[model samples]
Target chain A: MTTPTQQRLSLIDVVNRCDSFPYPSDPRLERLSFLTFIVDEIPCGRIHSSVVPHIVAFNQQDRPVFHITETTISFMPWLADYDSRSDAIAQMLNIWRKAPKSFPSLSGWRDELYGVYTLNTSPLTTKGGAALAIERSACGIFGVHAYGVHMNGYVRTGPRPHEVKMWVARRSATKPTYPGMLDNMVAGGMGFGHSPGYTVLKESMEEATIPIEIARNAVPVGTISYTKLSKDETDSQPETQIVYDLELPADFTPTPCDSEVENFRLWSMDQVLDSIRSGEFKPNCACVCLHFMIRHAVLTPENEPDYLEIAQRLNRRLEFPGCKKWPTFKEEQ
Target chain B: MTTPTQQRLSLIDVVNRCDSFPYPSDPRLERLSFLTFIVDEIPCGRIHSSVVPHIVAFNQQDRPVFHITETTISFMPWLADYDSRSDAIAQMLNIWRKAPKSFPSLSGWRDELYGVYTLNTSPLTTKGGAALAIERSACGIFGVHAYGVHMNGYVRTGPRPHEVKMWVARRSATKPTYPGMLDNMVAGGMGFGHSPGYTVLKESMEEATIPIEIARNAVPVGTISYTKLSKDETDSQPETQIVYDLELPADFTPTPCDSEVENFRLWSMDQVLDSIRSGEFKPNCACVCLHFMIRHAVLTPENEPDYLEIAQRLNRRLEFPGCKKWPTFKEEQ
Candidate 1:
């Protein structure tokens, strides 16, 4: 058995030696870095708490060919908060080496870059006896997002120059949890035992009042990451977000169901942009959705003639103020 | 514990008392019949077994509500075979019930006419203990003949007026199990353990070369029934089917992934209708799809100018050699 310090060094060395990290400019290569983070920096303890991590290789056609390695790590924050970074790194390496036992001959790993962060410390268990603590550790999440590029539909005159409609949902004032806040059309924490897609689909029905068929119609855009906030940072909880973008008809109406949402409205893009600029859309929920729109070019400068850069700037300036800061490391190009 | 005979008697008593049995002629009462079958007949087996049953109730908005009753009965050929009639009725109920689990709760079950039928089963079990089974039992069988449809943007012309594009999939010749048979775009055994939608989705992806998104758009039109063919019917397999009405772009192209399809061609509606009329389409895969299309108006008289009566005759004609006999019962509506 290797000491924790030795394990950490071995993992760091293996990661540095492996040519898996992609060049920063190449978006595809970034997956390797993310995979490394999942397999190296994040404690195996955290992963095992939620799901078993498996390295699956897909053919050029995107058909899963085989698994190169598989392992279940626990989501134990204590493992992540070891006194030395080397200790944490070593634990991760030990877990990686053991991963092959579950999935023998896996070709490579796929990275799901975004996940939900929740403070609920639940012990997650699988049928196969793999178990992990979910609340304090990083877990890979999956989900579907209904997404489409919103081109300028016929515009109606409004106070703002561009009358593009933005979908906004009001968090249910009557909800036993998270009452009286503005939120995305649909958002929720991915639970330990559910697929991200299944989780999001469930959330959309529960929160946004979107029909399941309609929700399923939402295309799966790529993923996004939100750093988890720490308890001391703010009253707001720590959570990483996996965001999916969906497009609705400009005239689409949402009827809130359950206690997740109280109401919904179609706001003009300019109004939303102005709200962001004025610090009115202060919640991270709004920021996440807004970021998705920007990343996907759902709302671009050209399309939103009255769109102000200040809104974008404000969104960028907002940080997960409650999240704990990790040691900063430079990535090689 | 009740003996199998006693259990059957109890089930029969339950079915007789429930409003679903003996098939209601009034369309409004038909919906009750569908729900009654689920509540009374479906056994309490897992959803993915060879002989599972289900019931689904829909509100005014067509959102489904599910109820999985726990009951299991032995297959008794000696005791009049209830599988045939019960099969279609049960399947329609399951689809009805399962559909809404995906959406929000709408209205409560009220009086409204709804269609019902049985379909082939698809079953699956994840590495997790979660198991899903869509049984091809008596409840899962049904038929429909839709008319007036176009495929790949091409209108039918020539001797046979309606241009019909039927989806035909050849069972994998290399597959050790169920090899080289004609099948629906989606068809599988009961123990395969996958959802009906998932099974069909896989079928469409594998056999039709349709993208997952596009394949999901295919809508369920209705269902059909076929009597068990032999004394060993419980052991002997009867072909199962679920009908869908899909209207594809006229220019749609299908890229066959494997040799499952020996060759495919677009037949003019007249030819397809002629084939059905002449009994040339046969009882294999092509006929099943054609049967569904004709019942749903995808192969309508107006669309396929030549086969106007084909669908009508199919529903009423019991003499068609390929058509399975409708199950018989002492009580009739």
Candidate 2:
């Protein structure tokens, strides 16, 4: 294994891995294009060309679920309401779940539902409901924007502000996604009914065995967003991670309480940077670390040549819609 | 004037004021397009359609400086090196400076130089050289990317992280640009020969009576970028501001030392937010305050509905090239 001081990947390289979609500067960016996936007149997702034939076949059923055109794949006008669209999509996804060989992404089917929202509608807040809800695992295949919360737990080690150490979690080898990869101290998908702060508190206890009092101290900092396009162009996932920072006491240590994490380790900022440069952390989680570093002044304009580019890439604007209003979250005593 | 609480602008509204360019979602975005300004075969700026006639007239001189095509306006191939291009552009600008009526932007020319740089070359760090240096006031007319440094000085009042106050500055009434506007505690353009850190320190002392020891403690955070396109489409300015945060002692107060600032006042977060919602702060300075609030957890996901959008807008991706590397600086005793 290479030492921590060995040649390191530039910060931009790590960001590019997460935000893998072609930039405007890239040549031939049009070669890997997808059709817009519209639901209830809102552009909610994208559909890869390879998946069009399967959708076309599904449309040939006694009742067509989708209306396909050259440029877009939209829900049938008859499926107007949220419940009808979600049920129809769930029924279709279940069919694919059974034939896992044909739809590889459905092999790890998660029954947990994720809200498909527009700028005006949110399952958690809006009086008008989301466009639809789909199984969490199927979100990437549909190219829908997914939301999550990730918290960086750290401790100030010395008198100076930059002297700090971070709590890092390694994913359990048996986990379905990103098995054995490094992650932030606590992270979880924003399930259909949960607020971001609620998710953070819940994940903190479930994943890190933190007490409610300590976990409630997590502060919502900002967000890091990216659109990850799979190499085969079969998956288009535009995701946003609502980031938080929890400054733990120097004596406090995290213990894993769930199968999601294999173990927890506290490392200095240098160790974390080396791990990030070595691609040990999951791409999005690495981005979260970079976000924390940038905000806390670990990486400055003088030290990181790609400082500005990294900042912009960490917040790539998605064409699809997000919730117009976020739900207010309060800790349950 | 309307009170801060009376029909206040949303956070997204404040962000839109700074980044007022056409997003991909805008339908009529093509109408306000400008041709790319290429220097040494690199896209460094833009040229408004109305200004093409002026360049064409200059090209008619005995020794043409520009080669204008349908899509782009580029410097002549003969002007290869940095000196030749800077001298030639300076000569042309001098001619326009004499006829201030025709070139209205040059009317307030300060005789200060600003570097025109590409990704590979910076006036401060690159050994090769910058593309050229032009008059600071005329950068907007040519649509070049300008750089600056903005510092947010704050004091922590309570044990809690969000319980902090910010130092705000009011621009002098006699200033040329945005006269009497509200600004951050300290801000200045990235002049030709200065580094961002150096600019921050210099401006800290020159604008506000900050000692070198205190200014050196300013921590470099991330950056904020935006493309401000004028309503008439005559000016296209893409700017990047390197952000800094300084934690001031509760006892210290800043007094305006120069004519650039009228005075400095420390305000509570509530007052600052009210001013921001009322559009009382200068556009870019408002963004800086928003960024500071975000990092310090003053504005959170639950409280700010437009949190995600605001974060993305604060770091809008600019197409023009920026410095590939920044210079390192040490505080002088």
Candidate 3:
């Protein structure tokens, strides 16, 4: 109601509200069969698009058995019903590659394979856990916008609430997606064949030159999830980021050891928030940063009018799934 | 929608929808000027009843300045605008006490003083930093229902990753409050003249035998806010709990160190949740326990259909004020 200095512009708003896009309202998308993506016997996601033809063509290969109904497509309860879940996913990927117009390109650093299942469900606990597949993080934009884990590693000065600083990274200009955007000190996807813990450790070493000893100490503070609808409207991204905070000593400096990052800078909290407000950081990373800020009490419910909404929306209840209570993930074949 | 077994509860049907009292349609209460309770010039609550005569009487007593209007009553911005903020609050309390029928007894254990402010704002930062007052928590049920903070501490045994245990307490039967109601392992109101951090420490020592070393490691995970209308329809309670989780070792036993708690038991997570679902735990404590369950990954967003709704409702935005930008609270005389 008042002239807005920063009512809804907080990092949590831009990234979190993408879920507000109404998929249920799109008749064309709805007319398409809703294939529920399942894990641990729970339906985590659904194919909201008209991908029946693709499913049919891919099924012709004598792989991936699915229940074909007028209103839905469901993977059979048995993962062995298909030769291999990953192989079937690969076939779909092959189809997308053949017709670039249908599915967009896997962009930038996200070209690397990432995990796309409900976090850490297994055959011992789930009927079809063995059948889940993996894909490049970018492909999830068009494919199933699977719930993925994201970790942020930061450093502080001294103990006793000394001056606080955050380790921030700048994406390489050569990166195809979000190139040269501001990022957390260290961030990474829960790639296929990796637990959130493993991914954090791996990313700590690769993304920033953080030692295993320090990265292991990173506390899993909380998680933030959002359903992002990209500007081009080509894909819908439903993701859940498992957030972490690793406090470092006064002398700790994060050096970029991976090409994904152009450089790393230790910036004050004010500087980080300022950049976030100015839209310098990638949307999701900014949200990840804000998650840290709120948890750290740097951003209190008193200071931000949208604090309640931001906090609620930060973990928007997806009609989909999240990895909590999920069993430990199985090894990738 | 399906018969039973907790699906997404319609807002009207929430197990905890406490606003069932028909206040909006009640002309007597509606006709009240709805005096606003403001801190640091931010409106936090309103006197729901038509208490104009009482306000006028309190102001006549050579103390507490007030702005009386046909539509609202407001605190003077400066104590010089009155005698003193505490004096004004005391006068209001005095008026309520004298008219025993007008305002009921200060029931339960909340005769204790609590800080009611806009959070930690500074004199240089706020318009009325020095004009805030302390009040009895029980009185808040009728007065402003000021937002309060509650903390939860839990423990997990190392032997069985399959099993998780939470320390829960039973209030003494002889207590004035909801005696014998199951409470959090450590729960306390943010009293006047106390910071949340400082209060957590004080309550930890008094309620549980947790060593400071282990208690200091407690994490301020997040907060849960709710508005409850007493079943008897006498009062409306709006509260916000800043949740904490202090994990204890496998062998740690919580000894009730004070007479406030008659007993302490290390409850299994299932037992804790079952008690909550059955409403055996104090409503606020039950809600607090649920907050911990959701965070510890024991209650995944997947298994619980109401995960999103529960999460959102846990921090329902109050129509009144929240402690935002409040300077560190000044002590009461």
Could you tell me every candidate's TM-score relative to the true structure? Answer: 0.27, 0.95, 0.59
Q: What is the lDDT of residue B295 in candidate 3?
A: 56
lDDT of 3: 0.60
Candidate 2 lDDT tens digits, B1-333:
555457788998999989988875677577876888998677888888878887787778788999999879988878866787778888888888887776888998878877787765644433334678788988988888888999999999997778999999999999888888889999999877677888899999999889999999998889999999876767878899999999999999999998899988999999899888888899999999999888888998778878888888899988877765544554331
Clashing pairs in 2: none
Sorted by DockQ, highest first, which candidate order results? 2, 3, 1
Q: fnat, candidate 3? A: 0.10
Reference interface contacts recovered per candidate: 0.00, 0.60, 0.10
Model 1 chain A, poorest ten-residue lDDT window? A143-152
Per-residue lDDT of candidate 3, residues B1-333 (tens digit): 123564433322333643333333245445333455554455555555435566677788554577766545667666532226566677577556666565554423345555444544566533333235445644444345454455566555652222468878989998876789888888777655555556677788888877788788775656766666554444566666776667677777878898989898887887776666655667777777666665555654435544544554555545554554333434321
Backbone Cα, N, C clashes tallied per candidate: 89, 0, 13
lDDT of 1 at A289: 44
Question: When only chain A is evaluated, what TM-score does every model earn?
Answer: 0.44, 0.93, 0.79
Error of 3 at B213 (Å): 18
Task: Name model 2 segments beyond 4 Å from true.
Answer: A1-7, A122-129, A330-333, B1-7, B122-129, B330-333
Task: State which docking tier applies to candidate 3.
Answer: incorrect
For model 1, the local distance difference test gives 0.34
Predicted model 3 interface RMSD: 5.9
lDDT, model 2, position B209: 86
